[model samples]
Target: MDIFTLTIIVSIVIYIFIGNYAGRSVKQIDDYFVAGRQAPTLLIVGTLVASVMSSTVFLAESAFTYDGQMGPFVLFPQMGTVGYIYGALFFGRYLRRSRTTTVAAFFGERFNSHRVQQAAGLSIIVALGGYLLVVTQGAAILLSDLTALTYTQSLLIAWLSYTAFTLYSGSKGVLLTDTLMFLLFMVATLLFTFYLVSDLGGISAAIQGLSQLEHKADIASWHGVIGAGTEFPTAMDYLIWAIIIDISWGIVFAVSPWQSSRHLMAKNEHVVLRASIYACIAAGVLQVLIYGIGGFINLANPDITPSESAIIWAAKNMVPEFLGALLLAGIMAAALSSASTFLSLVGFSASNDIVRPSSPKKTLNLRATRWIMLAIGLLVLGASLFLPPSIFWLTYFVGTVFASSWGPVAFMCIWSKTITASGAFWGMISGFFLNVIPTALQYLELIDLPSYMDPILIGAACSLVVTVLVSRCGHVSRQEKVYRMRLHRTPAGERDLKQTKISVIAPAILALYGCVMAYLMVTFYVTPYQTASGQLLPNGQVDWATGEAFLSVSWALLYIPLALLTYILIWRSYSPGAKNIEQAQTKA
Candidate 1:
């Protein structure tokens, strides 16, 4: 084996070993389900980051950045950073405080209805299923290209191996291994990236050359800077309406059932909050590095297509066999980490949501749960075999489904106290059709727009407003109504919270991102990059100036001080709700 392949194998083995060791106490449901609620902040951060920054970021974004107006565009990073902020401020701590095993439990408790549990359960199942499809599709694509393996063989091999792996250790191993895999993947990729960039001219030389090229190839504007381009390829905003309209879809996950699955694994609220902050910082860095590196590769090559192939092309050409293998392994690691967690969460939801049927005799049927998980594995395995080859397109369809259905309901549940079960049901159902069905039709080319953000924006808005209107106009529960009244009476919490749905730090970071964005925007407008011979290169050949390196440094400066304060707050919170933090906090 090459050194990189050997490194990857050794890394996977070590992670499995770590997982086995950590899971020595897996004797019951609690142990298997939530790591016995003993997860520390670092593990929480690692696992959550691993889950979020999957192959989608590495391969799909790498490929798509080419045709995109700006490499990866600014929206991807902005949404990711802001999404984590929402999770931290709006969802994470509350769910931790709510003391629920599953986010579904939170919905069930808050809505005083079994259907809400069903809602949480169903949403997670779909998300996980979509996640599995993404994992298998990526594995097939990567292995088929990288190794001698055929696509089918690679997909099957991956599916079977992961199935065997997860069956043995269940979620306990998932937790431990995800943590280890994330660390390994990050280290390997970052080191490989450092070498790759250094091998290209130093950072400054690379940037100066790229800036010159940017002058020749402005795809968004033909003759002038702001001149509009054509349909499909020219339209930069794929999900413009969704970004503005359905911000909640992205925001809800930090605490909703899909996201809360990762959070509830923590030992306490302190861990949850710290992990949230960690997500924000990690997301910021990931955005700049992945996007900037793609731009850098294009800077060297000049003419690339589709943009998504940036990582794949970089692996073959720029990187040597050994380092390339490690990058590939890191890709594998991202897929595995996300898929396993997705499967575990889905399996839990199936048993809890569909089959088990909430009852007084609820022992959580450990054996039944295992069987349900196996059944889910089989279904995913089948999909992996028969499904389309590209996860890039397919997973988004799944994401659209989840984002539309659960997205609206979950957002209101966390941020708005007035949402009722009836309202949630009607609104979410409407959002689902508006978001997913139309998007799917568009993807199939039965329609015009790729993914008009308008439906989601409209749906989410209507859902919340309608949910509130229905709740208020109809027979509202006295106790729930009273609680909301009391909460509103405490205007200190409301006023302190209203403008900043995210944390205090979010506004600052956004302002910073804004300033950076303005500078880049100005550069794009005023200056055109040039070749040494004064030849204007094609669009792919040009690049935005290196804003990423600066963003990374800026993000660090902002994160450190805020993190220290977060730590102090957590110390105080955890001291009162000591040892059995998850349960203790729940009870209190």
Candidate 2:
């Protein structure tokens, strides 16, 4: 017990050290909001990994993987790649294209409308809050699982620690601690995966065991079982949803605030691409490893919670004491890294999204923002304790909200120049509520929506139809569209975006990684797809030779080189005096 407390204390101390390391970075609002727009690509990648991957990838993904295959949650990892790529290839440029602090603020400036700003702000709040709650809940669960700490005690510690870190250094603090947390978690999870997989006797016997227990007296397949209560998504359905919603949410969610926040915080347009491209790959790797551990654990211990802590369990029951302590440290790292990210979002959203201060005293405004962040942390802790949600479900729920609201809004705003502010607002409002209404209905036992299988699909469609019809009928014209497209003077630093460093490498790397994943589709099913068969895990080990040949360890190795190539290609690919993303991002 003392050793376990020592592990947590050590983790907390590391976070504090990182926070202090990031000091001397918060001199202005730009620094607070965008991390001075001068963060190195590596640091940007760290923050992105820490933030976007967050609690869901750490705990929720493990939870789901423990009981089932990654199922539709595989989309969670795949979308990590997709979201970052979209942000780098298109959304990042557009965000910098518009001269505003928050994405919502940009809408108001570009369209000359406050309603659009408000709508966007509301969406940002929901997305940010939901994400924060998800991470906070995971942290609470961690405390409960590992020690005698009550859910509330764990939540308070998680929230307060994260809030205090942000209050001190803003994004600088977030970036520094996030990097440490990332490194710690990755190494720890790798160790855990290695031990867990090895324990099952070189993977083959593991598979044999899994096959023997496949049915477990439950429904044999999806055809036999139906609904969330039965066992979440069945096999075929999980695979199909994994591809469809996973793909859509990947691109759509990325374009909005989640990845955009990182892009905005990046040192330069180049950093945006570099970070996203690498962050995507790292996130994917993290998922594969955690799920692999999940698979191996359940293969050995048949009855595990959806929130799988098999690594910890295995360490206690199977491994030596010192190694078990190390494994626990890694789990804490995963949880802490995620907590820092949520802290950053909650702070940034409260400061910029919900309440954008126009006060002249920059220092005073920053202090106020810090206070708001602390408040938000408390709120998140409360939410986590009171409204504990299943990790995968919470993640999907938040993704659905983001897709329905910001996804379509960003698409129309960036690509369709004729999109009116009111039109965009209404589109988002309708789409956003499409999700909320259904949720409320279900809660009240009002409607019989088949399942949570496609909440975002319906919401996104509604947003599109309403906005298009309204835009055409009420205000926009063909001429206005053309006129808006005409290149206005770009922002101060962004003379030409295509010529920027991101244009060359990020896209190709992302495209290639996707191709390889699709072509071979790795044979080792660490995380079994959730099905009606009582969430049967893949008990058997897969022979690497029998698996798809495309899944190389170097899944997205070229992204780094591609990013370097992007730097050089900038000279050839684009023109000057066109778009000044730097100047735009540098300003408030």
Candidate 3:
């Protein structure tokens, strides 16, 4: 076998070993489901970043940027990171307080309804099952290309590798293995990106080169290669699509089963908040590096076909052999990390939420959960063999299902006194079906929906309307009211003044990093457009008639610093000092 193929095989073997080793700690369902709720900040952050970044970012998202859509594509992560703060403040803490094994259980317990839990669990199975299929195909695709194996053979290998460890080790194995994968991919991506940028004569010259490319004019502009020939015909069309999708993704970050569930594994409410703050920073930095270099790769080799293959192509042809092998392995790491997380949740929900409510026996529940996980893995493997991969769009479609279906209901469950079990159950059901059915019909060409009428918008609006209406027709019981109040009350372990002060430093650092990014964009991106004055584009190669788009895009980055500063203020209110005052007022 080639060095690249050998490297990938070795990595998977190591992960399997590590996962089984960690499995030795599993003594109960909690250990299997949430790492006994004792995970520290690093493991939580690792899994959070690993689970979300997947091959979708490495391949699908990179393809968008490679095709000169970097301007708008970057906004998705920008908004998504903002959702992390939302989770820290409004959603994740209460989830840990509920002390549920899965996000589905949180819903069930919060409402005191088994049916609601089953409904939430079913949504996770269907949605995350689809997501699992997408990421599995991603890993197989990577392996097939890097090695001599056919797609089917690679699919089987990838499936068994993640499944074996996931079944035996459960969350303990997955968490430890995910952290290892996270560190591997992160270091590999940074190294490859640094080399590529230097090769293109640094960021300044690369931007200038991108502006003058004959076939890809406006590549560096805010709208990014827009025209009649592109997927987005007009600037307005592109901006609207970007904004809508970005907002959906923001909701995904806040409440998606995979992302929010990581908080359930954290050691305490403080770990949830601190890990989320750091995870947001890590994801933002990595995406900017990954997506930022996507368009720049075109400067190195413009003929890369099937833009999804852009990253793989660069690894083989643009970098040294060792670095290339490591990068390819990193991409596989992304796919495996996500696939394992999705598959585990599928098993967890199927057994814990769907089956456990009926079984009621501990041994039967454990046996059913493992078997269900195995069955789901096999099912996904079969699907991978036949399903045509559309990695980026498929990932987006399935992920947004959670945003529409769960986002509104998740937040309301915590903050709204009027919401009832009926509202949540129906809201999840409607939101999921409304989003899925319309998008399916549109794709089948049975109906033509306008570009502005994205199904995500329709489904989310439907969900919100139905939830409010259904909630109005019902009443919150005393039990539900007390539960809500308890969630709001501060946990004794979380009321630490010293830890709060320490946690503040992370956001403070991120706020400063945001300042640095804003400065760099101004110096590298906006300044060039301003001085373009026709010299940078000597042959009228420049696409824009003015610099408005450039200036607006550059200045918009300031929102990051502004948002982080605001978050720091909110985080401080969690200090014991603030909690004591609130408690005194309540007593009064």
The top-ranked prediction according to TM-score is 3
Residue range 1-588, candidate 3, lDDT tens digits: 888998999999999999988888887888999999999999999999999989999998998898887654443337677677677667987898899899999998899888899999999999999999999999888888888899989989999889989998898888998999999999999999888888878877777777777667776667787878786888878877777887898789888999999989998877887788788788888888888778888888877888888999999988888898998898899899999999999999988887544445544345667898999888888888887988887787899999889988999998887899999999989999999989888778898776688889989999999999999999988888778777777777777878777777766766666666656665665555545424344563433444433433442464455457645554555676664432343234
Model 3 alpha-carbon miss at residue 433, Å: 1.2
Of the two candidates 2 and 3, the one with more favorable lDDT, higher being better, is 3
Model 1, poorest ten-residue lDDT window?
A: 487-496
- Per-residue C-alpha lDDT of model 1 across residues 278-379, encoded as one tens digit per residue: 666665556556655666676657566645557767876887877777777887788777777777788877876655456657668567777888999889
Worst 10 residues of 2 by lDDT: 217-226
Predictions in order: lDDT: 0.60, 0.62, 0.82
Better of 1 and 2 by TM-score: 2
Task: Give each model a TM-score.
Answer: 0.79, 0.80, 0.94
Q: Spell out the clash pairs found in candidate 3.
A: none
- Which tens-of-lDDT digit does each residue in 1-588 have in candidate 2? 666667876788778777866767678777777677677888877777766656566566665555655322332335445567655655665575443566776666656666777777777677777777777777667667777888778778777666667777877788777777777777766776667667777544554454345633222111222347654355455445555556556755377575676667665556666677778778777876665565556656758554456555776776666666676766666666666665666566556655434663533367777788778777777677778466766667676677787777676665665577678879989989987777556556676554344656678888888888778766765543433453232444543555353445655665566556543333333223222112333664333342122222224343444444444444332446533442333231
Candidate number of the best lDDT: 3
Any runs in candidate 1 off by more than 4 Å, and if so which? 68-77, 212-216, 219-249, 300-309, 356-358, 449-453, 478-588
